[model samples]
Target: MTLRGERQADFAYQAVYRYMINLINEVSTDTRVKLPSLRQLSQRLNVSISTIQYAYSLLEKEGRVYSVAKSGYYAWPLSGSPSTLPSGDLLERLYVAARRPGMVVLSADEPALLASLDATLLRLERELVRQHPRHLQSWSQPCGVWELRAALAARYTSSPSRCWHADDVYIGADLRGVLDILIEVLGLRGSTVIVESPCDWLILRLLQDAGVRIIELPWAPDGRLDLPALEGTLIEETVQLVLLSSAVSLPSGVAMQPFERLEVARLLEQYGCWLLENDTYSELGFQPQQAALRDLVNPDRLVVFSCFEKILGPEAPYGYLLSRHMSGELQRQFLLRSFRLSSIRQRAIARLYHSGQIDQHLNTLRQLLREQAGEMSQRLDHHLGDQVTYRMPSGGATFWLGSVHAVDMRQVFQHLLARQVVVAPGELFSLGGLHSQHVRLSHTFHGQPNLEIALAALGEALRQAQLG
Candidate 1:
């Protein structure tokens, strides 16, 4: 009668499946409950994905688990329980993405980097408060504290042609917010916007919500955004903006080459479109770093954005958008049209960074991150060569992997999940929400044996799927 031992020893997977089903009834407060991720439950039971897959299939057949399209499996969506739990599907996804003991975290590209604030910098922050007590008295004005923008403009522009005055810069909630304002002020509604394919999904989602028409440019293997594919679509609409992430490129950590950047500038000028360079990942890469877009581009058509949120963790709230693209009237319209940037949060985070606290920590963090990336790429190639192929990146925290098979990544995803490994499926990063046989994993989760186990489980899953 025990769920542990198979009542019918011939079916080892059946026991696990039934046990999961019964366990759901016992542990779940409501008759309708959510399911644990295949990965999390897989690790806890020391079981392979075959068992979990079989169990999940059986549960789905029996009406115990509900699958939601574009999301994941959940306990019956109508969980009758009065208690509100974080949606099981979301919790399971988070549990898999978050670093846990003996769990694989491949979904994000965060660095395995860390350091503490230096005493001097900490003292500077305190002194800023003591010396300028009145500065903090009011919510920082919309334009931002004048001194920080001056500092930010200096940091943002390295080329003489790109240098900006403090008044031209605006500190906003984040890149999405910045883009929204830029579009509104520029009267960009219904205008065509060009974006790189396999792009940052959140940004694409924003454009979609705004009813902005999107034209996707295919990316070449070297990570160059395909200028030719864009040319075909550019003529159809009044293409006003071309958005790009040139350094530490997301989803694929491929930075654009320097010469290509110069060409990008020239192309935009010819096309008579404005350029918005999103360099959020600029500082988080391995290479020496490329020149900022504005530094090399015609300033009248270029607006550059860079931020600390990605490089220093999302907790670091400060970032700046350098603008020389707007005219006197547009600048006034930008300022007058919208409430000032998220002024207070931007100033505080910038103050910590400006005080030299962030710089000191970054030096040590870079070294650790580089070493960890080496370890991750090595293991990925070793375990999943035939089924997966990846190129060790030259200098970014993330790398790309693809399978030649026509298989949906969801199988690999479920397989990894049973092993507690979570990676962002490539389909989610693709244009049109199309699923692909690829995924992106970050090396920042290195230095842990769980990562190793997860990779091995992935191999087994790939093999099993291939055979079937």
Candidate 2:
């Protein structure tokens, strides 16, 4: 065959392989099920029989399927694929497991609290109440308390290309609420959006619930953004939005360099699509200097979503949406649907920012997180060694780990849960049943006494899963 023909054949085989995997994930139960025969699959996919055979052979080699003497291929028993579960259900199960007495949770993505702000917050809150006694009875503006919005706006005004003002900011209690409003205001229901694979599961759930069509673009083997695939999708599809983290992507923790962000900005601009940049982990990046896509993308086309929860703990349930070019109608709709946050808390946070305490806290928090990540990496090397493989994250609180050999991570999760440890299976981060051999372990519990024990338990669980 010619080189071009070989390439085409390879593409065809890959398509069949992916299709078969999805099909098996959707249909497989506790029992092994027969897959479509080679001839039938070839006819259905409009590919040559040899291509289907090759695909099946590869799956068999990967232990995802097996062949009978003459009956044909059969899918391996999935034993209840976790990816098939609803996102809410899976989350609830994990939450319940984490709440068990004496449970060591390595699955939670929430950052650890490095310092207390009780005294500072109390002082600010008291001052606010004392200064304006009558203001307590009035509700804050729907957009947010003016002082907090202004304080937040001041931080982003450094970009000379874009003028950011208080009006460009909208504050909410959490990222979920902010995202919900954006989805509604932008009229994104049923529209196509591109997201990174192995992304934050909560965001995936939100997009799914919003009735939006999601096309997942995967990272390259070298842990960089797959620019070619992204551009090709932009060329072939009418994507309304591209949602991604510019720094420290969740689960994977791989960050895009400045050059990559520039290329991404260029593609989004060329395609005339909106960029919903998730900057939740940008501040936590280990790099001293981080470049934002906002600097490269047109301000009119970019909307940045960020939250303080990762840095300030759940007690501070504050998140803000920043966009200078939202249409008046869209902004009006957002305000109409949004509820007001606590005026006193917002003022207190603004005070924290004004006093530069927030900056100090962030600096300390980043240093601690960096140290914890390094210690976790060293422990993983000491404990799991060659049994698992992972990339040390550039920043962020979690580690994405893949088993060195084929091992069902769902079973590993269960095994660890039984031993009073909780872990997040890779299925939680994907929809297509990929990454079944991977798991996401957070470093939030790094300083706890049980951390080493939890790691040992995890190693044992992987061993058992592989042996089974």
Candidate 3:
């Protein structure tokens, strides 16, 4: 309402509004609709918050965008979608749904035994003190410390035909950090990227943020990759990249079989596309194998992303990107971005490997997880068997549950949260916004007794929702 300065700001806002309209028109699909954040757009367009606010307000009035309470704005309603919940709404809604204190979180993929981290943390502390002087002096190389890389290479080499070179490994701050770098380095924006339907929520978010043309291939009800559907998609279209959680499917906890992986590899080979194997849950599986689908194909055709954050906890933030032939490109990108890791973390992880403490930790974890999963599986089957359908994946931190009826899983999830429990709603995992009757529960968050209670509460919630 002011004079000349207001006029300038109004002009900027109008420009940004037009840019946003063009962006939404170009990127949004009939099923998957994505929109950029106010902060992102403001920065990109060199505009202020007031300008963005005005633009967003105009868009809202025009029905071009809709804002979630505390979350950002969305471009349009996804056609044939089960839920209109935007990714930005997920964290806030989950937080609000948690109505009581000391809530049981069955939605997170955390360690079942928090005490199991004691020894690892102690070892890390010792390593930090030992390397205090060195850590203070310098930053890590873009490719990371050689000691850690060698340790990881040796770990892979122990399994037959899975030997890796230190140079092929590039380390980053964490799982998200490494993935962000890979998406940019690989130039996946505007490329046709294939992912599983009901895939990892984080993966879906990342792909959507990167502006990739996403194609979701539905996984079979048995939790295996729908190979026929995948083959059809591969032959019918040109796919730039395929993201697979081969070791353990996040949220769903399904593990892709070796032969199933081989078939996927064949399709990629036939199509000449890159397969990024997400091995975040690699160390947590039952029958841990060294040979991956990457081993079956031209090493250049695959990239493996794994991190110690899941195993060693979030305090130890480090993950590796193993690209057989893209090391040079990754190195270039690393240098260009000046990405660096803490030398202390690299040393701590290396020390964990050399002292054989890593193996001990993993062995204990595997046995405990297997037992915990068994108990949780039995509890779910006994309590929710009649109301929901589910399968105990071979190895992973979570389980997938689908309702027997056509119910909105977000509502059921919110109901469970109100009852002091939280489970991941299925809508978050889909790019196409399908599968609203499913939910994910992570067994690792609580011990058997508490988990039993959570499962029982979930059953009651389902029943109440159905009746209501």
Number of the top candidate by TM-score? 2
Runs with alpha carbons beyond 4 Å of true place in candidate 2: 1-88, 116-119, 134-137
Regions of candidate 1 where Cα sits further than 4 Å from its true position: 1-103, 112-127, 134-136, 235-237, 325-360, 433-435, 465-468
lDDT of 1 by residue, 356-445 (tens): 756666666777677777777678878877778665665556767777566656667766666667777777665665437667777775
lDDT of 1 at 47: 52
**Cα distance off (Å), candidate 2, residue 215:** 0.8
Q: Please give the CA lDDT of all the candidate structures.
A: 0.61, 0.76, 0.70
Tens digit of lDDT per residue, candidate 3, span 80-149? 2324333457654553333223567677666534325545665675667665765253543767888898
Of the pair 2 and 3, which is ahead by TM-score?
Answer: 2
Record all residue pairs in model 1 with backbone atoms less than 3 Å apart, i.e. clashing: 33-75, 38-417, 38-418, 39-417, 39-418, 286-395
Position 341, candidate 2: lDDT: 53
- Alpha-carbon shift of residue 306 in model 2 (angstroms): 1.0
